[model samples]
Target: MSIGNTFYQHKDIHKKTWRHPDGRVSNEIDYVCIAKRWRSSLLDVKVHRGADVGSDHHLLIAKFRLRLKRLPPTPQRARPFDVMKLKQPTVATQFQLELRNRFQAPADCEEAEDQWTQFRTTLTKSAEAVVGR
Candidate 1:
């Protein structure tokens, strides 16, 4: 309360920020203090006594004159569907059929990594067909 122009000098109604439980004592214990550098940005600060919050303390509001710069829109990418739904009997049957129709199992002599890649691709395509993107 001893700062520069930020001091509270308004009427008693506007100055009181808190009240005692006995409904007899009130005090200006709450505040919205701003740094000296950005003091000009603080347009107004006051207590809203009419806003009911079921508390003894009144709501303190501060208004600023700042304008936030808008950021460019971000590009959205398509996300994969959840494959866990395959646990359902109907969904599992459809997914299995789709995979069986498209799957070309790697040859017996193929590398393990190649077989894994093919399996993953087949599973992904089956899920996409059964559950959508």
Candidate 2:
């Protein structure tokens, strides 16, 4: 996403000072009122005026980091148990059996083994989602 104008320019990241339309001057930025809560963390803010190719409004970039309180870690696993049963005994062992059963060439069996390895990685990552224990 950062490929096209994905970055923001921060002239004053910490705080943006702009005159409000009202008689009383106030800060101005694109965000809504709630941004007041986040303004304090602003490290840099910049205004970029000029057509960014086709976009009408000038682009603005802001950079800031949140000061979050300490948080606990979350843990997850690859799978529970059932998916294991679906897979053949040992991938190598089953490779031999299936190859023999189908009269498949060794090269073909090797290809199948490679496929199963990919499946194993994807399946493991999908099933494991552990949090605080």
lDDT of 1: 0.78
User: Candidate 1, residues 1-133: lDDT per residue as tens digits?
Assistant: 2232236467888878899999899998887767776776777777899998999999987777875679999999869687678779998888888888998858873688989988888888778889877
Q: Which regions of candidate 1 fall more than 4 Å away from where they truly are?
A: 1-8, 67-133
Which structure among the candidates has the greatest lDDT?
1
Winner by TM-score: 1
Candidate 2: residue 40 Cα off by (Å): 1.4
Model 2 over residues 80-114: C-alpha lDDT tens digits? 44545335456545444543454423454358777
lDDT of 1 at 66: 74
lDDT of each: 0.78, 0.45
Clashes of 2: 16
Off by over 4 Å in 2: 1-34, 72-133
Cα deviation in Å at residue 80, candidate 1? 35
Supply candidate 2's per-residue lDDT for 26. 38
For model 2 the local lDDT of residue 120 reads: 63
